[model samples]
Target: MTDDTETDSDSDSNPNQNESTDKQLISGWHGRYYEDFDVGDVYKHPFGRTVTETDNVWLTNVTMNLNPMHFNEAYAAETEFGERLVDGTFVIALAVGMSVIDVSVNATANLGYDNIRHHNPVFHGDTVFAESEVVSKRELESRDHVGIVETELRAYNQHGDLVLSLERTPMVLKRSHAEPSAAEPPGWPEGIGTQPEDC
Candidate 1:
């Protein structure tokens, strides 16, 4: 007796059935391995933050930006903006920080950013969200365990207007190949976990 059935090769393969190098992720880790990224993939970051007067002023003053347009509402009202402008560096940092869970949670280091541009002004009370798309990738020449991933990062305001855009490159460790942890994998040290004897 003989029976034949054709199976589609494009069907999803179960990791348990196949010999995959990827391992089950531990709890609290939410990042992709280098092998997971694909060109043209888009990740919409999961948070939106509203800029505040305090946020702008603190960031501006701490960074030594004495520009009145950022902290002085009265001075800004005299200008065409009609209100204080949110510092551009603060906005960029917030945008990129929101993307950490999706983009670089397991990354080694950020290489650099290029072609940074501000398209529209952000002011107090304006909410912003970020999205990134994979642009390109390459294996690092000097390193065999990591590859470089380039992405086009974009931030949009509540009204759907593009506020900023830039290209960021990060060094990512491959899922199949990564450098072994140096010490105890970056957790609690020796006697730190012990409860206080007095308590």
Candidate 2:
């Protein structure tokens, strides 16, 4: 006699259940593996964020970054640009953070950045966005379960102007199911770094 209600654990009868679970697992960066990236791979963050006047003002004050170029329009008017400018550090932080959902959310450690260039100044009311391109990947010599990823980070404004550029390095797990191990890679290397061969 067979019990019709007894469900087989590996049975394909409940297709929706397995499908839904798979969708949930891959929905966020948490489950992404180093295998997900390769040279020339680019991940434009899923969404763009608008920068507000409050954002600029509060960030400037809270961080104690009271430079006239960022806070005092009257003082800035006396300078070459003639208006207050958004802090460069603010632009860098916000832009990089924007890309976390697609890049570093599953990363082990932020190795470092290189060839940082402030191409243009960001101002209040200017919305910023970021796109990261994976420029290089190397398997750790000692750690079989992780890899080093180098990325070229570019930030742009709503006006389609390049505001900043840099190379970011992070250690990412080679496989989501791999066991955790003690593997630490060195920080940014010295010298004329290689540029990402844009494809």
Clash counts for the predictions, in order = 0, 0
Q: Each model's TM-score, in the order given?
A: 0.76, 0.71
Q: What tens digits encode model 1's per-residue C-alpha lDDT throughout 67-92?
A: 99998789999999898899999999
For candidate 2, write residues 1-199 as lDDT tens digits. Answer: 1454455643556667755432211111243468888799888876777777677778889999968778887898998887788878778888789877777756778899789999988877787889999899888889877788899999998889999999999888776544322221123233323322311
lDDT of 1 at 164: 96
Off by over 4 Å in 1: 1-26, 178-199
Which ten contiguous residues of candidate 1 have the minimum total lDDT? 1-10
In model 1, what are the clashing residue pairs, if there are any?
A: none
Candidate 1 at 114: error in angstroms? 0.7
Q: What local lDDT does model 2 show for residue 18?
A: 52
